[model samples]
Target: GSRQGKDERTTSPSSNFLLSHLQSIIGSPSFPYSSNSPNSLSPLLFLLHSFLRICSIPTGRPIRMGNACGRGKRPAASRDTSARDNEPRVAVNENESDRERDEKPAVTPSPKASMKRSSTPPTGAMVTSRTRASTARRPSTNRSPNASRARDREKEREREKAKEREREKEEEEDDPIQKFITYALNKGVSGLRAEFEELRLKTIPTKEQCSVFHMVANAQKNRYKDVPCSDDSRVILKELSMGTDYIHGNFCGTPKNPKRFICTQGPLPTTIVDFWSMVWQEGSEFIVMLCNFNEMGKVKCAQYFPPTQKETFVAGNAVITCESVAKQKWPGEVTIRRFTLDRIDVNQKRTITHLHWESWPDRGVPPIDATIQKLLQMVCRSSKPAVVHCSAGIGRTGTTVSIQIVTELMDSGKSMETGLGPFLIKMRKQRAGSVQNDQQYVFIHRLLLERYMSEEEKENAKFVKFAKDYDSFMV
Candidate 1:
């Protein structure tokens, strides 16, 4: 019983504490407390009555029981009169009351107010109702008609544009040209070969078909004119940084990787300076010379680099020196000549790996050559773009570049069928007349097919002896 009594005393609000708290609320000048105020004191008196009832004390009498009220016990007076006399009250003037009420901000109910409000009975007052209503009716700014309409229109436009895009995408999915391209790209080497054979026997690029303006205008001698290097994004001499004024070579690379090749024509004797300048400017590490110095008794390409005996040649501001020449082992299918090109003006030197595929006749395919594949591998491994060129830099050059791209794509896990056609199209866009004839196109397809073959499939006993003879022809 003693422990229970001590617990009650510890948990209950001390009389002094309650008295001081009530004094603060009633004493504040800004508080809307008034003795004459009917509803205000009703709530206050009701709360005190509830507390006294909880203490198991009589509630009808005003009693001073805490040390905080200046005396320890209730004064000997009647309950109602003492309650009114001792309670702190502030006087109010009608004018002062109006000003204070207007200026005094409404008090927001604390989180504890809800629990406490229900714990006590209603005091016949509207204090709690007004607080809840003020919170519920929090002010918000109004929007103008134009602003609201603009927002609605913006949302409507977004929805409409989204629907329009969906329709366009559906139309594209149904497009015949897009379907054909998609079909062609997804083909394996075998399918590509069959397609090429069909095209070779059936199709040709007529003059009327070649309508692009720059393509028609930049042709050389009108004979090799269709294979003009793209002038718009043509490779510039980095040393000079002069745009499109130097060489007839355009920067052609895969869409995923753009700095892959400088597709250009075989350097003419007169254009040798520009060619070397391009190599140095592009930081080209490999010079893929696809044609010979002469083909079918005609000088198809200039002897751009000096031979073994004559080790040096000067071209424009650069001096070309043969560093080392290694001919592909007997039946030399490809001759690899390493040259150190010295920029005389800048006193800088860079070594260029020159790959020469000699026996590929003009507009004709050589006997299945492994040397080209070897060259492609070397180019793929190199960090810089290979400067690739043939007699016109379109036929043989196109085939070789296409092979390199297809092989690279295949090695990267892309299906061979989808990459070659798009690669050839992109190549021709950069340098016109690429893969010029049906034969060259077929050669590209055949090259990719050979990669897909088994060793047994490649080993033909019928041509076993011809292979030996072919080596002699290559040498």
Candidate 2:
């Protein structure tokens, strides 16, 4: 009886000490050790009783802590305040009995358990406050990589569109060819040869060259793989007068209009500097571009001119500024660009006009002559040789000059039938492949024949009018 009493006293003191410790932890405001409130102490008391009973048992089995709520019970969450007071209760010993400490089964912890396991409470923050703070710090989880890339692409496209708009706006504001464009667009192709003959080409042959003292010329600057320029009329930069003493162009036209042309190839990327030097040397006022910057995936000509208005670019010793750009009424058919060329070396400035035939068929003739005629009239008024170029500098260039020469001859009271062949032959001598094919030759003859027939009809009309007046008077 004495030994039993001693055992009871020892166990009673230990139970009292555990209950006091648990109460102190619950009362502390700094640390929240359990999610359950003080009202839910029955489960904790049951755990304490089981622990004490296990301590009294003399079995050699090791003691292990077990979940009081047991497996499948609702997890303790910091935010949840509605934990049931009448939940089904299972002995905690049953949970521990299934697995030993050395052979514990792997289990995925709930969010609450994971947070508690991973983080230590920051200073002045209890577990609850820290958990809430951690949740707030996490970034939004819904955003994806593909969505991010798509947004980036959309922004890029918008930027490109904005740049395009700026370019088009510049073109619109700088265009000055409205009057010429209006006339060309209003004009249409005619099938009647006699009617069309009245539609004369507007250009005149440049004044003839008096002396042939120009510098050495070469085929190196030419674009076509197999074409060459004739040496007689080939524009040569007067011996070291400026730069590029050689260019693949010639003086074309009559003595009456000398210095009328310095025809050359469409400027190549490697020869843009040379092209500018030639222009500066010749003091050219007009630049007639017969082809586009590119065609059919091939770059027909280098964009040697300033791409934007008032943009200055240096070509060799020349500083060229695209001072203004003008779109015709038919913007798609033609574009007139004005440039200010400043020869930095000589300190000279000149305004240059660029007449771009955007709709001129590449390596082919225009469908109608009216558009060509109107553009020619505008540029041919310049006294200085107008620099004309196509991709190869021979095909379209030859055709353009041929028409101009024919117009000038007709104006001077020359017969087309007798003058056409000599003019073409002279042009060929000055530039080897002037008329590229029989088609271009035929085209020239057709134009002249139509003009001749139209002149005859005008004379006939004049005579008939006179005869009518005479007969009426007699009556």
Candidate 3:
């Protein structure tokens, strides 16, 4: 009996120590290592008492740690409770068992992305904040590649358009040099009649040159007397184009702000008055007689710069008037022909060569332009020299000059591959510091190319139809 008692004492004290340690962890009164309350016993003392009671129960009597209340249940938490009476239930062991059961087999857990997050109070705030911030600013995930590319292309197009406008501005400043180069290329060049590489066309004018007529001179000699302009109307040059376009200002610092249009108002717009006056001053030999010849005249421009001055036509830029009769030693004869577009009569009457600007055609304009083109072909067929003219004899004049150059390219058997660009460049050079607006230059080329291609289309259509018929017969 003494041995059993001794063993009981030793076991009881050890169990009390463990229970007291657990209750201390929860700050329960039953195991309070620290206590400021008067109603509570030290945790070690209560735990020791409970161990003694449990020991007694092994002898067959049951041990109850607390006094039996009206109902055998723990009291609710309150400030009045003594530490010993408020002992925690022994459910810690059951909670541990449940956690172990629910947990997955311990995996070598993936190293947490933010290695610093695993801690006692795992706030994980830095990592979470970083994740949230990145998610908040993520690029929109909704756009398709096509939409993105289209936006990029649109931006690129705008950039290109800006660059083109800048380049055109620079070009206006560089006009003189461009014009000089064009002149160098086109000087001593007549419409395709002379071989450039084979012969020096600069040699004195010949019978072949004689074969062609100078229609510009003819128009000058036969120009009607007068068509007075209204005193209120004025003219100005809005811009100078190199080949097809211009910057927004004039070469002379006068801002001739040109509006884009089809130029169907008259033979030429009044914006180029200064330019025309300058041309007139340069050549008195080319007399432009604006007159009222619209009714009987076959040419549209004839109404303004009529052909009454046909007798004044000469070989050069001088009137060669008998000033005091001493300067009349070298005499030049003038020949005049009526300008008309009657197919049979005009063709026969047109002995010399000519390309008439007044005879050319375009939409909303008289067929004079067409007649000009026809006269040009006839001149080429018969191989005659001709000249083209208009009222101011500059814009339409320049256009006719350009057309003749294209025909010359054709007649010389030279491919247009080497001609059109150089041709316009030359025409601009021929006219002092003149520029074709982008539309005008493009229109001229389009018209010529369209006509040229129409012939090709006719030929191609015939061949295609024949091939289809042959296939059908074979089937």
Instruction: For each candidate, give its TM-score against the true structure.
Output: 0.50, 0.48, 0.24
Q: Which of candidates 1 and 2 is the stronger one according to TM-score?
A: 1
Q: Model 2, range 1-475, lDDT digits (tens) per residue?
A: 2111111111244555564475455445543444254444546655765666556423222222222322223323223213522232122333343335225433334456566665544445456776778767766545677778899999999999999999988754443222212222222122222222322221112223312222233334557745565556777666343344666667776535855666778888767888888888788899989888889888889889886798988887889899888777432367788899998888889999988876766655555345656766777888878898888887788788777776776566454333245566667666556656544554554444333334554355433443343234223
Cα shift from native, residue 31, model 2 (Å): 99
Give the lDDT of residue 352 in candidate 3: 23
Worst 10 residues of 3 by lDDT: 246-255
Candidate 2 regions with alpha-carbon error over 4 angstroms: 1-219, 239-244, 329-332, 448-475
Which prediction has the highest TM-score against the true structure?
1
- Candidates by lDDT, descending order: 1, 2, 3
Question: lDDT of each prediction vs. the true structure?
Answer: 0.60, 0.59, 0.32
Which digits, one per residue and each the tens of the lDDT, describe model 3 over residues 143-174?
A: 76888999999999999999999998876445
- The 10-residue segment of model 2 with minimum total lDDT is 1-10
Better of 1 and 3 by TM-score: 1
lDDT of 1 by residue, 1-475 (tens): 2111111111134554665476565545566653333435645554574464356432233333221222223223223344354333232222343446446444444445653555432444345675666655654335667778999999999999999999999866764433433443345334555665554344334444344324433333222554544545466565442223456676777634677888887777667777887787778899888777877788888777887734898888888888777778423378888888899899998888888878778887765657677777787677788889888877888787777766656556554334355566556666666677655665565444455544674475422333343344334
